[model samples]
Target: MTAFLSRNLAARASMLASLIFLTACAALPRSGPNKPEIYDGAVERGGDAQVIFVNDHVTRASNFTPAYGFSNSFRNASAVGADEIRAGDVLGLSIWENVDDGLLTSLGASSSQLQQIQVDSGGYIFVPYAGRVRAAGSTPDQLRQVITTRLSEQTPDPQVTVTRVAGDGATVSVLGKVVGQGVYPIERPTRSLSAMLAKAGGVAIEPEIAVVTVKRGNSTGKVWLTDLYAGASNDIALRPGDIILVEEDQRSFTALGALGGQTRVPLGNEMISAIEAIAMVGGLNSNLADPTGVFVLRDEPEAVASKVLGKPVYGSQRMAYVLDLTRPNGLFLARDFYIRDGDTVYVTEAPMAQWRKRIGAVVGTIGSVNSVQNLAN
Candidate 1:
């Protein structure tokens, strides 16, 4: 009877050990080391974790500014004064003598002479009788008056007309992943970057991932194409020699942990809220996700961290933002919160769900053992 009791005790101990092991396994996060801890109503900073609560105040964070190309007044000035001539421009010059001709009549060449001349390196064009005439920095009408005044000495009345033949000097280059890659000339009516892009056959890449870079003179700036079209303010006017490039959009984020699917989501031309991003990845796994531990991992700028927390944080290269979806207003805050590029949205497994799964597993193990014992009997 003592041996029988001893064997029964050993069996109970073994069952307890097996249950403990299963419980431990189920309690652990499925996302491995990347899972976020449950968030309470407090801010915690440790190691690489800089945790912040999602609230209305977070909307004021400076880093929330959308990235897109914008032009200052100085850059927009290029759109103005389109009629001004520049060096390297080709001009069509015509001169007519009022009196059927003195010099031109002798040559038997009609009363007028038309010549296509290219502006010289010195910004001047050589006229037949007018000698070196300054054409650069002057409109066609201005150059015509200057030529007529200069030729007054050679002929009693010289009529001069100047027309721009080609604007090789004032043109902007549209290249890089555009449907039509070429140099587009700038005319009197200045064109905006959007107009130039439309003329160039639109962008070849998807707008969300594509960045529009504008190189003007020695300065270079880039902006998301979506931002440019979302607002009129971002579509800066194109300047001469400005290079516009539309390259592949490479911004994306990874959704892991208790999400419905672990995948990389590209940040397209539109602003994506936290809720939108969660929905895009098929939301959280109902059986395993912790409602209070919805975390957005981001490599936040130090300054942004300082502003959001209202104090300086130390030793964090990235931030771990937690949202408690169990609260009445938690869903509202999630909808308002925006996700940045390279952010990781992680939903930790609920503790109770882990317990339930472990119980089921342990029960199944016991049933399997009982079935084997029955067969042995």
Candidate 2:
């Protein structure tokens, strides 16, 4: 009877252990939500996000390719004259006369040197004999002509020269990620965007990821630093009061789940594909990664979302794009697929990996229960 009772107790313990294992399966420790869980939480079923497969058709339909180039206004802008005068400019004037006691000369000196004559806000400069002369809109030669004409009425054969001295007018403010940041004068050699960037000692960041922005008056435009030199049309003309900013590319995507590493990967080049992004994060985890369940999550713009889903979606729509690397053309599609900024790359755990964890948990529980029963006996 004792032997039969012992056998019954053992059976009961095995049953209880099975019950415990079943109960704890739901609380298994996982890196992230599995594939089915993600699908069940999609927007089509009143969830927070939508799921789509990455393929050739979807790639062609969605137009989210971002490239850097200037607009027509910025590209077609004519270069400004380097010697042109503007307000707030300082001019160095010299006047010579035939007689020593001329209008601009002294008793012993035949020439008079006027140093650092600043142009007023009204675009006029005050000369000794030639009243207020408009010097802002005119070049040095034009201003010299005006000064000579005005002084000729008082003194015969008057010679005048106007030279632009150091001033804030007709200059561009170069700031941000450049070797040298300062207000650079727009001379003949530095009249274009490329020339001005060189004048500022080039961009401090990598050329492939560098961005150049130009704010001219109320209009603003931007282009990749590499693109600036790729074509002449992108080499926009620089204007006075222009603010040129060079900065590193801010585009990046987050890598998560069963990858080799979980971190934010920057777009070091103009364009980076999904495969490249995965490789950047040290590729997938060999032990736990599900090659068929790699996903790229993004809050796609309404236009791109609409085209992707073939329906109108208002505002930004949350989308999760699945990439199955096991397919015949999966790697090719991933190579063609581009990763945008603020995107999340997730790789789900393999089914066998979760099973392995469950098996481990059950075996550990069974061993603990056997030890307790032995002690009780």
Candidate 3:
């Protein structure tokens, strides 16, 4: 190579290197970045739970049931009652020989609505006579012992009778966020949570989504609906008056951007890209859209922290992941950006666009007031 040609090529290369370095410096940014933070929550709690106000109007406790992704760890939340009584629930009521013969005959004659029987609003049947209540909350054997003790108190030698005239009144209600939400009566008493869910319509027919939650009344935890239904009796044996709810998966989003119209976007996974999400929202109005300050605001900002450490934690450090969409390859980084529920994909109007909107608003106000005065005159 000749010396002059080599010198010229070197100069061009030097200029290119300087330009590249300056660009890198511009990207480097002089300001310090925010800290990386984590959360201690699961995605299911509103995609990770930090409950603010229970929506008495929009949602009730039942809405949080398996019917609504709210699981009923009821067994874990509270104890399960015994499960061995049927339609023929019997009660033996008798007193000691102090009991008049006429009284004994009258008992046999009337067969009253149950001797000193009290039915709790929960449907538990309690009898106070032989003190042996079979259907209220006792198994056959438990009632026998109670009757024996009552006889012992009344007569040194006592005879007790047992018979079930009424059926069980335990019902597991399925409600909210489900295709079929109503009260389901359980007769067998040996049915499981799965059986109850099946009776409650399983899950609704929705595409690209499948998940069921069972929430107990005591706590805001959940059990998988399918796991309960893997088989008729895989787990979760139920009782009378238990509550089971089935809920649809609420994992979706909407992408609103600069376009002819807004779009409601459905997301299948946890992650979405700015470029792709924009496309899903019908792309931008290239003629007027400003891609510089494309800001994505996620829902439940408080939930981001606990999601990192695996629980609801403070999010003071992790404000949010901000991205610049103007660069050519910044689209790649958008893929890693996870869009959560209730997230807002806001595209700021360019300066010209904002000015146009303000002008239109002012003109509309003037036109309205002028029309009002003209009508009055």
Highest TM-score against the true fold, candidate: 2
Candidate 2 lDDT, 1-377, residue by residue in tens: 87777777777777878787987687888789999999997977779998999899877765376767778888787888878888878999989999868876778998999989988878888997789889888999999999899899999989888899646777899999999999988888999999999989988887988899999888888888877898888999988899999988788899999999999888765577889989988999999999999999998888889988888979998899999999999999888888888899999999999998898889988996797567445
**Best by lDDT, which number?**
2
Off by over 4 Å in 2: 1-23, 370-377
Tally clashes: model 1. Answer: 6
Query: Model 1 over residues 1-377: C-alpha lDDT tens digits?
Result: 86676667667666765776666565643564433333322244335455676777875673474465654753455463677788888888777776654655555554565566888768888877778888999999999999888889888877777888546777889989999999988764447878888889999877767788888777788888887788777777776788888897777878987888999998776678888999999998998888788888887777787778788865444667778898999998888888888888888878777678667766766776565444433
Clashing pairs in 2: 43-49
Please report, in order, the local distance difference test score of every candidate based on alpha carbons. 0.75, 0.87, 0.48
Determine which window of 10 residues in candidate 2 has minimal summed lDDT: 60-69
Model 3: per-residue Cα lDDT over 1-377, one tens digit each: 56676566656655654565455444432112111111123233333433221122212211121122323444433324444444334344543333434223354442223353434444345544444233455655665466667556544554454443334355566765566788665545435666566666666654234444444344443444554445433355555555655455565565544553465665643245556667776777765566654555443333434443345556432232345566664565554455655565656456566456555555554565455444433
lDDT of 2: 0.87
User: Candidate 1 — which pairs collide?
Assistant: 68-223, 69-223, 208-268, 208-269, 209-249, 210-249
Report the error of model 2 at residue 3, Å: 14
Candidate 1 vs candidate 2, TM-score winner = 2
